[model samples]
Target: MTRVVFAPDSFKGTIAAADAARVLAEAWASVDPGVSPVLRPMADGGEGTVAAFAAAVPGARRMPITVDGPAGHPVDTAWLLLPASDDAPDGTAVIDMASTSGIELLDELRPWDADSRGFGQAIAAALDHGVSRLVLGIGSSASTDGGTGMLRALGARFLDARGAETAPGARGLGDIASADLSALRPAPEVRVLTDVTNPLTGARGAAAVFGPQKGLTDPSDQQQTDAALERLARLLALDPAVPGSGAAGGVGAALIAWGGTLLPGAAEVAHLIGLADAIAAADAVVTGEGAYDGQSGDGKVPSFVASLAAASGVDAVLVAGLIAPDADLAPFTASASLTEVAGSPASALADTHRWLHEAGRRLALAMRGSGPASGS
Candidate 1:
């Protein structure tokens, strides 16, 4: 029997990683019932990070709580509570920024007003539960608030020139004259998971590179936000030049200020979910994401999985909702794209699971024909 491992990330805004893996497994099984499919859903510290953990870890509990949303409204969200183990006697808490202060929570872009306070509040809840370790996934943020809102929720103070507290979101970043950590809660050991490598305050930094997507379209606004982040970095004694400092609209810097460590999201998640072990034992490995583009080569799930497969001398296959026209698929032994299978982007997205099912069938047939599947 052929052993196959399916490890895929979520198709952002459409399918969860776990769901995608399950559907793909079903499709593969339909083609070759004798094939043994091993499902291993993946994430990159974004919206589905906690869910990925929940699917991979046994006895992981969801701790629901209400907190301030990105738009300053109360929103119900939950964090994951992983039972204590020998490595961590007090247990572990897994939190995702996208669940609390993410862009998906907003009806419309709040730009300067959206904040990460909700994300911080979730962290506080975990701290209150007496967790010894924190695994924070900072992705899909709604604001470029320099993480002020998050720090504030953890009992830190961001004051203006007059010693008064500033406003919320990026709107307050420009006014922050000082920061006080005296009242901040003692933070547990934090491991920040993210794929971004942008710095905090330049053309390639958070504001200049990501601000426009968060509704900071005007060049002046981007510059101002960048300057504000620079000021915040100075006030907090942080090095803005560090890689990953700009993740989640500067929330990366904020977490670091709180004594957190940063690591690649894909690699970290892969390790946590035991992807390496699964891949090593599999006859073939399959991986994918929402879109395969130039950016996907940079620390994304597909590329990471492909590299792992290559290291293990195993054939790797890729399945994507949409493959960019110029994306290089050399890493994969075989590749299937929903866009090509469905004949149009809208059609593919309209019913993603159906298209994914077809993609899986095509991949299975292709692999069975060749000694090892070859990229199409």
Candidate 2:
């Protein structure tokens, strides 16, 4: 039997990684009954990180909680608890911004107003549960508050010049005077996860690189927030030049200040889920994301997966919701785009499951040498 491993990141807003993997596997099986499809959904410590862990680890448990959302409203969510192991006797808790203070929770973008308090609240809950280790995925945050809101939630106080707490989110960055972390919960052994590697300040900083996407359109607003974050870094005695410090709107730096280590999200998740071993044993590995663009080569799921496949002499195949014009597809044995298959971006997103099946069938056929050319 031909062994194929299906490992794909969540399709962002369209589909969860586990569901996508299941759909793809079923379609591939239908197309080629001789194929042994292994479903191994993946994540880069983003939106579906906890769900990915839950699916991969048999004894993983979900601990439910409600916390302040990005828009300052209560949002119900949960953190994942991986059962105790020798490395982590008390268990490891998985928390991420995507399910807590994530951008998707907002009705609309509130670059200056959306705070990361919810993310911090979730972390605090995990800590209270006595998890000895933390795997924090600091991605998809809605705020650019330099992690102030999160710190506040963790018992660190960001006070104004008048000795009062500053307003929430980026809107209050300019009002900071001093910080008091004495009452803050000391961080346990923690590993912060993210695909981003930008520094905390300057041209490639959080404010400069991701501000616009979060709706910080005005040049003046970006400048102010950037300055504020730089000041915060100085106040907390953290280095602003640290790579990955700019992740999740300065949450990376904040975690560093709280004594957490930053690690590559995709690589960490791969190790956690035993992706490398699976690829080594498979004839081919298929991986993808919601969008494949020039940025896909940078520590992303598809690129990382392809590299592993190459080292193991396993063919790597790519499928994506959309492949930008400039995306380099050199590492893939074959590639497919749901947009091209569905004939439009809207339709593809509207019905991702259907196109995913089609993509899987085409990929299986290509491997069998009975399908037309693979692009799209």
Candidate 3:
């Protein structure tokens, strides 16, 4: 029997990683009944991180809570509660910033107003549950507030020149004069999952590199936010040049201030999900995400899986929602693009499951050496 490991990340706005794995497994099985598929949905501390853990870990529960969202409204969201294990006697809380403070939560980009308060509120809720450890996924952020809003929610005070608290979001950062962590809630052991390595301020830092995406397109705005974050780092006695300090619009720095350790999201998730072991025993490994582009090579799921497969001497295949024209697919044995199979990006996204099924079949056939040439 051919053993195939199905490890895929969420396809953004389309399919969740767990559902994508199931669909891929079904599709592969349909093409080759003898094939043994191991499903391991993946995430890089992004939008689907919580869902990935919930899908993979038995006895994981979703604890729903309402918090202020990025758009200044209450949003009902949930965090993952993993059952007690040898590593954590009281259990672990998996919180994702994307659920509360992500760009997706905004109707239209609120560059200056979007804040990480909602994310912090979620963390506070998890802490209240008495989780022994925290697994925080800080990705897809909507604000550049230097995590001041999050700190505010956690009882840290961000004061202006007159010793008054500032407003929320990035706009408030410029007014901050001091920070007080005296009243902050005591943080438990925190493991931050993030792929970002930029610092809190600089040319390659948070505001400069990520502000545009969060709607801080103006050069002046980016510079202002960057300066604010620099001030925040100084006020908190944090190293602004630390790797991952810029993650989630300076949420990384905030977590560090609260005694959290930063970890590579993809590798951490892989270890947690046992992807290495699964790949070792598999005949082939398949991985993908919403888009396979030049940037996907940077510690993303597909590249991470490819490395694992290579180490295990197994072939790695990729199935992407859309493969960029300049994407380098040289690491994969074969690759398939949903857009190519479905004929259009719109059609592929509209029916991701169906097209993904087709992609799976194509991959199965390719593995058996009976399909057409595969390359995107």
TM-score (all chains, Cα) for each model: 0.96, 0.97, 0.96
lDDT tens digits, residues 145-183, model 3? Answer: 888888889999999999998989998998999898899
Q: Which candidate is the best by TM-score?
A: 2
Overall lDDT per candidate, in order of appearance: 0.91, 0.91, 0.91
lDDT for position 200 in model 1: 89
**The CA-based lDDT of model 1 is what?**
0.91
Clashing pairs in 2: none
Model 3 local distance difference test score: 0.91
- For 56-142, candidate 1 gives per-residue lDDT tens digits of 888899999999999999999899999898877899999999999999999999889999999999999999999999999998999
Residue clash pairs of candidate 1? none
Candidate 1 TM-score, true structure as reference? 0.96
Tens-digit lDDT string for candidate 2 (66-96)? 9999998999999999999899999999998
What lDDT, from 0 to 1, does candidate 2 have?
A: 0.91
